[model samples]
Target: MSYFLLFVLAGFIAQLVDGAIGMAYGIINTTLLLSLGIPPVVASASIHVAEVFTTGISGLSHAFFKNIHRQLLIYLAVPGVVGAVTGAFVLAHLSERFAKTCIVIYLTLMGLFILYKAIRMKSTAKAAVTFKKSRIIPLGLLGGFFDVAAGGGWGPIVTPSLIASGIEPRYAVGSTNFAEFFVALFSTIVFILILGISVTSWQIFVGLLVGGAIAAPLSAYVARSIPRKIFTFIIAIAVILLSLRMMVKLIFF
Candidate 1:
């Protein structure tokens, strides 16, 4: 298949999952593109470009029915953007294998954490709760660091963490989507300025935007009524599957 076709397929699949779960576009897209021999930096940059449009569309759709916490967005995005920029540069010089390894390990741990949280939350019959500012900052920092390092793992980490901290699932998802807009914008610009543009990157970007736009409204509808435990379980499963896929590639391929 042509590389363009590959990118389109990757984008479609990634955005479908992303729309349903609140984040996965970068994680899935980057991993697939890297497997196709794309450099980690290029893959990361391309995903960011696509994510800008995807997240914007999804965020707007989510806003129609969800409460977005602007204050939380500001607090989280500041550190996320900084961390993403640093990660993009670091990725530019790292070996793809090493980057993949790091991503696999991180995702695995994060997936397990989310899974555990989901199980605990399920038993309680209430979403986990928290309002501590101290908790938010540190979690945001960690989410930002991983997001940049692994090419957009922040959504999975931040969304669940926020939900666990007592925020409603709909709002947490919306807030994460809102914060992602700036993160992708800043990361894309940095990558473009540093790495130069290419046809492949543009193809992936367009595909992601298109797919995300199509899925956003549908996802918003579902997000409104989906139970917190179910949502957490679904996202956790996705993270675990993606993490395992990455690890398999690292180990045997």
Candidate 2:
């Protein structure tokens, strides 16, 4: 009972963060779950199930308020989906420690990248970098791979890259959320097919759906109204905290 409550509490907090930042739910939730003794693969899989609903609902809401680069989405989606599927398969066979190590490294690097971008954005009033299809493809593939390998936390890895590459912050975040919808869907299917499903997981899934449905619209509103600098700062802080948590667990706990 206590364990279930812990997961529930984690789910609520994760959803709130995710709603506020447009990402980080999985990274935070998986880390918390693993710390609570869930196997890494199971934690990843369970989180994916929750993300399916969260990303789907959030992506849709963002799409309404934000302009999505359909061309970019198309170019990135194929490689991203393929990479996610491949990573899921690889995760099924890999050891938990090995997988966790990879996630820690990715999160640490991603966090630093976001922090740097946030600092740079704050200091500069220059226009964001222009988006190009050539750059989007590679970023999407890399993000998808890490996302799948590390339980769908690829937004931290991808979002900052998009912004750094000159994409507008709002579009970058929206497109990332759009991309995550597919990644989460692919990962959830892989988990269900390869690992089998459980009722407890289903409850988590419902909780994610409920929380996400409520938060997605609110996030879209906030994303549009908030100053770009403030948004970047918030996201940067989230990445830093989440990354530090993962690193600490990897090194000490």
Candidate 3:
């Protein structure tokens, strides 16, 4: 029961950041779950299943804020959805132990990557490189694949990459969050197909829903002046620590 409440709190905090900044939910959830020794595909499947609902709430909120770029959303979503199916299928076939180790490594790297981006976002860095709009799909495909492949990559890859490509921050966040719905939705289907259907746990599913629902509307209405510097730093540290702990266990025992 205590662990369940902690899980709910984790979901609440993860969703709050994700709703506001458009990233971290998947990575954060993945890092924490993996540290607890949950199987990789099971963790990914559970999070994606939860995200199907959370991202929907988030998408509607972003839309209400008028923060989305419709063209970009479509371009990203179409390819992302396709990549998600492929990635989910591939991962579902992996042995649990091997998959768990690989995910810890990948997610640890992403923690550093996200930390760097968070600092950049905090510092008001300007994007010097701008890509043609047509360049969007390629990255979207990769983001989609990695998102399900490692349990989360859509926002971490797409949101900052889009901003770095000279897309506006809010729009990039908004569009990425919007497109993630399809990514999670289709990915969940593929996971169900490959692994067979199981709820994983209703407590977790409901916890995510409750947290995301509370945060989504609040984020959309007041998406400004979040203390990115400190919040993101803490998130970065948490990801690194959790991931490293498991890596050490695998290496030693």
Please give, for residues 161-205, the per-residue lDDT of candidate 1 as tens digits.
Answer: 676556766777777887778777777777668767443566666
Number of colliding residue pairs in each model: 3, 1, 0
| Pairs of residues at least 3 apart in sequence or in different chains that clash in candidate 2 | 129-166
**Residue-by-residue lDDT tens digits, candidate 3, 172-222:** 677888899999888878767766865677766777677777777776554
- Reference-based TM-score of each model: 0.78, 0.80, 0.72
Error of 3 at 127 (Å): 8.2
Give Cα-based local distance difference scores for all models: 0.72, 0.69, 0.72
Candidate 2 has an lDDT of: 0.69
Kindly report which residue stretches of model 2 are placed more than 4 angstroms away from their true locations once superposed. Answer: 1-12, 30-45, 92-110, 120-126, 194-201
Q: Quick one: best TM-score, which candidate?
A: 2
Runs of candidate 1 exceeding 4 Å displacement: 1-10, 30-45, 93-103, 122-124, 128-130, 163-167, 197-204
Q: How many clashing pairs in candidate 3?
A: 0
